[model samples]
Target chain A: MTVTKGDVERLIDASIGAAPAPTMDQVKEFVTKTLDYNFAMTLTEPFYIKPNAEILHAAGKKLCTVISYPLGSYTHEAKLAQLKQALADGADECDIAMDVSAFKSGQYDKVKEDLKPCVELMGDKVCKLLYFASLLTEDEQKRAIEMAIDLGFPMLKTNPGFGFSTTVDQVKLAHDFAGDKIGIMVSGGVRTKDDAIAFVEAGVSRIATSAAFQIMADFDK
Target chain B: MNKKELAKYIDQTDLTPGEPYDKITEFCKDAAENGFASVCILPTLVKTAAAALKGTDTKVCTVVSFPLGMDYPEIKEIETKEAIENGAEEIDMVMNVGALKGGDYDIVNDELARVSKACHDKGVLLKLIIETTLLTDEQIVKACELAEANGVDIVKTSTGFKKMLPRSTSVEDVQLIRAHIKPETGLKAAGGIRTTEDALKMIEAGATRIGASSGKDIVDGLAE
Candidate 1:
């Protein structure tokens, strides 16, 4: 049987939980190693952000990065600016932060406006949106999904690792609500393959776990 | 003019927090000189950009609730009014990710329609921010359906930090949206597009609009 990268990605996410990203040097080493792990690195700037091209060629891995970073608090212009920078930094995939505060503060119009520049920046590139707690209410959560659906983003991310991690309920909601539109991804608290599978069964196509490396290395026989 | 030849398709965004008014002025001037599609600024800076781009085709764009997509309908409407009064020609708003997860499609649809109406009342074009990474494929399709049903002009992805979904855009996903969306409807891809090749890939994938901080690079790449 051939081991596909997608299988490995699911396995690793299921096995590992969300932890802080590795240091740049460590990432370089990890990238050099041949593995089935998908790496997404969030950076504050372009400095020290390595592990692309050569690593993908050497190790056969994909790298994920973030634009604007950590918070969806910037204006459309600034968010767009960051999107361009993140792509230029050589990220294969990008996980963008949703404007949680804007949704929470009852600025509905502003919420839609926040994504314009980023949309313009990516222009059909792969991108993930970390909803975080913007959907404090059931209504908000549904609206958030619709937002993702309309934008054509493939993955529905649960957390930004800022507060709560991906929960069973959250994954289920994503799958149950929009299973046909996109893939569901569980991040934050998932630390085991079983945990990742639970999300997978819930219709999650991916899992974001920082412990992916160890999980893949220690897969049970 | 062809969309490619026209600078109106390129916009200069200035949503950086703690940015000085003078910097906004500079951005507006730069956008005008570069023949950008528009100048995206904060609601507060809309007037600054608008005044700077006055008499030029470079319109002013502003956002509401910013990077977040959770807000009451009324709040969004009010914010839309505020942005327009400040001279923003286009409006980009976030959608409530929470509500969609909760299966609250009605609220999502109603809220988006309301915001669209508010923007249309003032003749300003409205683009919805789906925050794509935060959603599922089914949800992504549904959101596109809703946007098309409403009068919303564009469907965009991502807010920079957290994603609507955990992963990034896939070629399959773009094609799926393209297959379904109406011809007049526009698709924007944001988040991790850096090089001209990346932009070209997205364009081939059916996205017409791109959001990025590296506008100059892409434009330069286009020139090259």
Candidate 2:
């Protein structure tokens, strides 16, 4: 099926992370071009463009800043501080990377505790939890989804674009685990319109990528 | 440098994606036994590495804005503080190479100063990774100068994450950094120093620290 512009726009979350810091002109260009779609800037180095959040928000764009991206290894306090800074800078959403290491070490409580503060801090703003699905076992991925759901996160994301791309099976697994209780966002390697459509067919609510503009442009053809 | 001496200069690292907890523990154990200078790990693993190396001289070193130096100065400061609280004795932060290349040296210097102050406040050594593989020689020299001026304790060569030029750690880069910095400033050669010969060449080129994942192999190769 040909993906519609509305469908692509609704499902796209243009992300800027895993690269060097873009200049202000680049940020402005991105904001202007992808105004119709959601934008996420990872809270890692380079994209800490919290200062530009106000401009993006004024443009009626939904700007999100991801915390402890690619590696949710920050201490609870650090993550909270990052979330607060992002919020103060005008971010409408906070996408937190789940403490996968803590979970893998069987420190489930620590993992939950790590997320609790950010969830509380976000308040009315949207909170999405990123679980590096490709790195976790099937059971672990399911449990992560459950925890995010229980925490009342608005969305659950797969991968931080650092590891493997989001697969159809992974998206389906998340959909099965979440069952519409929470939005499912698939990130990393959704490079084309076809890939995006396949994910949408798999029940993905959103797709986060650095290639959103390219994908959207490709879809118009 | 001999194997024993080389061990003292090594900051054994494993910043691999999806690195297991047990592997970090194992890295710490190996570092301690080998008399390595430090165990370089992710910020979250600092506490674990600290606990593992308790009473041992193997300091816990972690990265800030690691692999990519693009986070705001405030966020990097928070990361540095949290890392220190978790028992990180050394902080290896990637300098905002984008900012440097963009000619925003003020922002770059301010970031280094902020993180450096945080580390110095807790007596933690700070190493700034310049990602030399992605920079020209002039940019590399400028980065080292800025790092020294900003009070960074060590000037690191790369984060080992560069894929473009991918030169890793080289003797010429180490020599350039050593020549630019003060005598008191430390030079750390990281990225691709995978053999004993590479380690010795770095040391000979004036690197006081060598960051390598192949610490065991390099040391073993020394025996041969």
TM-score (chain B) for model 1? 0.90
Superposition TM-score, candidate 2 onto the true structure? 0.92
Task: Give Cα-based local distance difference scores for all models.
Answer: 0.63, 0.80
Models 1 onward score TM values of: 0.51, 0.92
Question: lDDT tens digits, residues B81-179, model 2?
Answer: 989988999999977777887788888888888998998888989999988877889999899889988898999998886432346778999998898
TM-score, predicted candidate 1 vs. hidden true structure? 0.51
Q: What's the lDDT for residue A181 in model 1?
A: 87
Which segments of candidate 2 are over 4 A away from where they belong? A17-19, A36-47, B17-20, B162-167
Q: DockQ, in order, for the candidates?
A: 0.02, 0.41
lDDT for each residue of candidate 2 in A68-158, tens digit (9 for 90 to 100) = 8657766677777777877777777777988777788878788898898889898998888998898899999989999998888999889
- First chain TM-score for all predictions: 0.80, 0.90
